[model samples]
Target chain A: MMNLSRRDTLRLGGVAIAALTIAPARARAETEALIKEFAGGKTPKNAGLTLDIPLAAENANAVPVTIRLDDRFSGARSCEEFLLVAERNPIPEACRFKFSPAMGMADVTTRIRLAESQTVVALARMSDGEILVRRVSVTVTVGGCNG
Target chain B: MLNRRTFIAAGAATVAAAPAIAAPVAVTSTTMLKPKGKKPRIVIAGGGWGGLSAARHLHAQGADAEVVVLERNPIFWSLPMSNKWLIDVLNTDYLLHDMIGPSRKYGYELVQTEVTGIERDKKIVRTSQGQIDYDFLIVAGGIRNGYDAWFGNDEKAIEFTRRAYPSGYTADAEHVAIKNKIHNFKGGTMVMTLPPPPHRCPPSPYERACVMAWYFKKNKIPAKIVILDPKPRIMPIGGGFKAAFDELYPDIIQHIPNAKVKEVDPFNKKIVTTAAEVKFDDAILMPPHQAADMVWRADLIGKTADGKPTTWAEIHPTMLHAKEDPNVYLVGDVMGAVSKQFGYYPKSAHVANYIGKIVAIYIAQRLKGQEVKTLLPDNLCYMMVSGEPKEAISVQFDYEIMPDGTISQKQIDIDIRSADLVEEDHKWAQRMYGDFLA
Candidate 1:
């Protein structure tokens, strides 16, 4: 006769439930939150923003990431500010950049300290009071900087 | 006759049960294989100045029956001439090269894997991929900066975590950050902290300060580059560097000896030291270091009674592994014998290259079942100081093994200057990069 520990049984049940429900729900919630934050409580439908991260990072400590906004900042009603937030960090706001019409297009590059594998969102606020947004999930196998 | 038959039957039953009892023993014994081959399989971890040189030399002499180079990083960086890149005198591309290119060229297998553990009894090297068996192992993984231990919090240390510039220091983020801080200088107090002795590039921090001071004076910026060292004197090139500091940037640069940074208050831009509170507009903190994680994790190298990993390989003067482990050899900064890291007692890339050649010879001879006579290694370090263009000082020494298994250093030359040494430095870097990556 064999015996199964209660803890082991519970763990198996949890794994099955996680495989069936938790992962999908977490992904959906994360996507919804990112969109809401980017559009300032509204859902964005445009595709003017692009995010780039390495397919695979040789050194986890510094994973190079780049974000580009295709929108032009020429008129008085141009882009005013940009915010980058991570879903997993204790503090979600990884970086925030503010720009003026005279400052030019939204292009900036700097290393961000990531806590773990999570969704990263880039949100831009236009001078016309419209919020444009984009989000991408980066899987960091090893956490550097913070570790 | 009946009693005899009964006893024989019982003995047979006992013998039948013996196999079942011995099953676990057999499984354990079969899992561990004894190291085979006439020459030990010497696996050198890290292809930095020390490990690469050891692998190349071992291969050349055909000493190691099988030589395997395990380097985590794809490239080997030249530490000595790298200063040129700091001031835009040289490019970062020229300072770093792929170590595997040379290992393969030299007829050795360079395994790029993260080594996780070492099994001494089974003579196996454990990695994320699988277990690699080796008769001997040399770990030249170099030093690991204990920044976490130095700084109380990880968040405050983020600024120094990666390269500030895309092209400077190549792979080093801290180097790039220091360069950026220097470049964007308006005017304020600049503090450079130096760890206690036995670090890679002894004169590096001071040299950096000198260059920055030179830049400041050249631009006539209202600034001062202050160096805080934990040592009584400056370092390896103590006198020469001090003289240069005095002559070049008299009032602009200040050298404060025996001052160790206790804390860094980023919010206030101040470094709390044992001596006094040093405030600065910008700060470059070089933290203390220890043997890399793999070395401590794998107990192949002996540790002190206090549990600290010995600096040099605890082997005899011949650099062989101590205890019963005859196949392993230790060299360079990882070895506890030398107090100073490379460049102090010939810990330069040139010296490491020379030692690598010697280790190869020893390995080849041992592979052929020939007795290897102990060989002494020569050390050379070229120190580059920043001024108008660049100036350097070179030190060369030879190690002499004494009786009772002790080794003493014989200084061959010190503070030797030359106009063409810069060219020699460049040639040395190229030759080393070519030879190691070859």
Candidate 2:
């Protein structure tokens, strides 16, 4: 038809506008504060965990996120707890999932609301007193949390 | 003189104001007001469920007020039973009605013209035909698709939203497309998305998913329905929807809560959510909804907590009249979610029909120069959860109008897929249609 490549760029531009308007600077700051509170000043190591989340999303309200712990890579007998965080949501903490030794694997999947294009962090706590972290960047084009 | 409590308890209410099981009655031409002075005219925009009810009720009350309805569609289609059409359980004849016959029989003038502008200062609606004056305006002009909210007024995005992913809320031609898509589906992922709350018929998406699941099962298709819900849990009917998924179609449908849609590429049939990017063989992508453009252009939209203008018209709960312009009344899905402060009422056709009657009584009383007391009509809803004719749930809500003018309702939870309620659902629809449209 018309110039296919130009049309594609225009389409991408539309999505970009949606992301920019949804997560302004103030929203990002709000999420950062929540992240600080959740961390409680403990330094999170970038090891022993994987955060599986979309790099970009069409809908802001329901983003699928998965957190998996690397039991073989680290010195952890068992996984105790896991936390999912959205860096710029009104409420940055998406959810908290607890795990027991009987479960064997510490993996959780759920949908979370994202205000804008921000980093999603997954934190996992091992029984051996180690905290592992992973971050994934997500760009949301349409907002779901319109009050 | 039936109060709110009695109205709710009596499932199918024929109150003092509205008589039930009545055939569609038209005001005789002899009874028409031929005033020595200017005749009082009531103009209802959007001749769908709510607008038609208000027009019919005004006629039934034997009011001297001249009633006129401005509807854009040539033939009337209902959002209520249209779902049955999508699953091939109901035909177009049942889904579509002759608007001309109803307008002529009811003695109300029906203009098959689009309402282009609302001239509030002059109390006239600027239509495609011409400017028509009115003494009172009833705005049942339903939802305007919130395409801007999703994709920043992108023409391609808006086009894709409307044509590619048919929401089937308006019962337009796209509804048939959705049905055809489902029927010809070759057994893969059928993605159905729900916008956040205050969308027309809260239980509809869940109902549609269950029905789609039934279609897949009945046809022996190897497909699954994935519902991406913007809310964290099942809303409005709540547990009833989840129970339907668990008991009837658990193997066929999977509901993911709090999964709001972020982006949709209709060209590629791809939808990206906060959770995952899903490619589907067929999809029903419902964008967020707003009141018709007339509500916004007339400066009738209210502000939300986020300081953004509301998607629907702001109206007083006691009488569904616009807060911005009292003479201009709003009903049906076009009315905002005032339930947060006023009371809990789902945006459904039945609730809208009830609101229309209440407005009619108020208008008639006012026309006679008599004071009309505040009224609280029960919000009644009957949702179909299965492809089978006899599987549905009926919800009834009663409210207490507080001294401050807000409503307080008692939560009545009923089990899902009740056969008795399903029978009531059919009877209720028939009587309701007979009461307003015959």
Candidate 3:
């Protein structure tokens, strides 16, 4: 299960990056475009929303992800819809969760299926025409016996 | 697993498990860690791996002295291979042992009390119970969490962080809390942070992460374990650990490189790192670490003529004696054992136990008016990579001390993960405990 190739001696503060099957450029661009379309064609700022997704999904069948509107985002930037997109999936659009200011905290915690190695992007369209976003890289690979 | 019979059988078992330890290089200590007094009283401060090694050796040789061990904990907690205790639902019997057995067997008086201060000027060790005098002191008190950099002047925040999410690297109670957290994980993401370098058990957090990932996956839980590493990559056996993350638990483990924990929001379950602000359902926060408080009071940490400081104690790499005081030795994670060929020495129990014995021998020789040699410690660390398949990886380091006082290093990494290595992992801990305690 392991390779003994006489790897580099251990160093501090950093280690070698493991190679992973990366999604194609075209697919990534399309995924970003889908995220943009969901944000009403506006580029989302990196600040307001946090998209917490697994760096790798053992079971791509149902990968759990959490999207939260940061408390720093005032009521003026309240999100209406939060869209999740998987770049390398056959269907890039996973689903969108509707949120309301009445809900107090606009957030979504759900699972979405992903195919090959891809990037998961979450976008939120605020009430004031401002958009917020976050992206996480999920390396979809074969999991353990059960996963 | 070591009962009375196993204690009697420890010698043969040592021969069966380990090849003979290499020659030792050491110098004398007077007042810090253990108890060997006749011509000279050698006081050891802590009852950790390093302290016990020195205590056992000094008393067993009957170095014509009264041997005593000043320990804080009533029981001894074995850290070697204790990572399994975090993920698997298991009793601590394997990791915990009665200190009385080793103390009685070795004929070292065990003082179970907290060390309040080390009065270096008077050569007196002030404990919670009382004060003890020493000719030489071994300050093997281990490391203290350096949370000042992260939460400066914020005692409430620090207290909250320690209670809510402990790194479980040092204390026995924290390990039990984390083990329960793993066993009864409700759902959502679990986070574990890796300290920068020179932390105790370099590969431990990684191995523990791997084991927990395997546990979550095996149990069919849709849980993700995010590893926020201060380092840019997995360290020590980097490639081997990286491979395990890539192949075995790629989906279950999220390793964010260069994510040094800068701020911790305990109430909100969030931590701001150099790279990202992470929000976790639960997290094991590994606060930055420095030598124990006793060392600071003793003025052992490297300091300018004024009062600037380094985290670890400044000690001779080979001799392990504090650069300022030859009689006051520092061992274990407390000392900065940097090598010329390598960087900081691996702060593993193997190295601690080995260096402890060496330090004791030096004190013994000095007590008898004999010369001491300059020997270095060898270290071997085993990490369990998976649980279902029961695979593990190991690393070995053999050191040589040059005439110039520079350390020459040789390392062998058994990077390949195998069931056989996992078997050795358990045996290694057993033999090590048997060696010192039995």
Candidate 4:
């Protein structure tokens, strides 16, 4: 048997589900499931994060996206980890970023692939066991994920 | 058992099994080479571009010597024209050739085994099969990508992420990994990174990015590729590639210099630099590279520009032999020969091919009790900038050996990136491949 890691299986599983009409409904369920996977089902507060991306991406490929933990909610003492998710991408969970005290700030910018127009979410975990959420809706005229 | 060439040409159904040998003693001097029934044997470690070139050059009709080549891989895959294949501009089959055929054709024995250890004093190469003694040794085993250089990036993480974003510099399978991503990508960011210099083919990352952008444009795929180069600006063929990026892929390709990938959060598909944290849909992360493992294991390393221990073998600039041992010669990407003309003799196929030829001549002459002549090898590199008809840029390197044994270097850029040079690049590949195989 081919060795497929959990992440790879999830990615492959996500694409396989896209073929069925259950996608749109399952996408919403998967988003919630992913948030729970990262946040452990804790109700996350909606504050302290600025998820900056284009409202309308001109190019589906190479859309510059940035997420920053504001000074008020910044520092390793306050913020422990960050996770980025595209609600509609074939693989909805983009990445999870962990920070240490050595890191002075919590700011990240990277381009991501998208399957269609969807809301991009950022979840920041607080040292006080609190999870904060920020979401931005972007219209991608051209879809980014073939799957 | 069928030779590796036949196996590879036969679709590499299976790799030839390693041969068993009894406890083997090391041969220390050339005198031991004159055995009762055998001739002097020259063993070339690494069946890469340089090793093959040396084997071909050393092959002479009725030469009173035995030549043997030891390569780890069962099949030979050329890295020169790989970018063209990745971007669907050329056939992928052209990238691979059978090494065993060439070695057998030129009367050299090709042993498909990994060289595990080397004892220079004893003139012995320890392979997975067994220990093989040699009169003269040429080490051209090439480079090992330094995935450790990136903070928080381990070899396992790099290997794990490679399935998603392949660093197609060494492994042929990585090309297929990235090629599939490119074809399957609906639209999204593709991240390609360039490690610091002293890597194989300095212009390759840029060339790959250019071809990728071309692929997006030609296929009408709404995609973008971001190139993160550690250097301050584009390197080696910088002007040519930059111009092509500006004129051809201004919208599709983004070149960001001095943006090193300091740390990678592979679990999240995120890369962190001092400036920003980058997320990618797909990526081709080229980690920093060093000389092959055996070179480091043998303690054949030198120093780099930053006074850090070099990942490459430091060798005599003119002689191509290891600075520490005269009998051991280092060629190709593994050598750390500094040159005034081309800084540290940029690791390119052309430069390695030239070094292999020169090293072969010097070693052959030395074996015959002839005075060895000082050598000055030229560096030639061609980079494909466009896909259709394949317009390319040509770079020529010239160097003069200073009286104090240092080199003074000069660079010449020929007729700008055009269709003519593409022909030249193709011809160069044909000639090099011919020299290696035919």
| Candidate 2, B237-356: lDDT as tens digits | 555778888888878898888788888777788888887778887788888777888787767888878898866777886667888677999877788755543222566776678778
lDDT, candidate 2, at B333: 75
Summarize candidate 3's per-residue lDDT along A46-125 as a digit string, tens digits: 98789887686543544668999886346665678888887777667888888767787776676676766667888888
Please list the residue runs of candidate 4 whose C-alpha ends up more than 4 Å from where it truly belongs after superposition: A1-147, B1-18, B21-37, B61-63, B151-155, B304-307, B340-342
Residue runs of model 1 more than 4 Å from their true location after superposition: A1-147, B1-40, B152-171, B300-313, B322-324, B338-347, B403-405, B412-418
Per-residue CA lDDT of candidate 3, range B281-321, in tens? Answer: 98888887788988888888886457778778889876789
**Cα-based lDDT at residue B312, candidate 4:** 79
TM-score of 1: 0.62
Full ranking by DockQ? 2, 3, 4, 1
Tens-place lDDT digits, model 2, residues A1-147: 112232111111011111223355776776656556655677779987989876865344556678988663334488878878776666667788888787888877666767667888888777766677899988765312122
TM-scores, one per candidate? 0.62, 0.68, 0.68, 0.68
List residue ranges in candidate 2 displaced over 4 A.
A1-147, B1-37, B342-344
Winning candidate number (DockQ): 2
Q: Each candidate's root-mean-square deviation in Å?
A: 27.1, 14.8, 16.3, 21.8
Instruction: Summing lDDT over every window of 10 consecutive residues in candidate 1 chain B, give the lowest-scoring window.
Output: B162-171
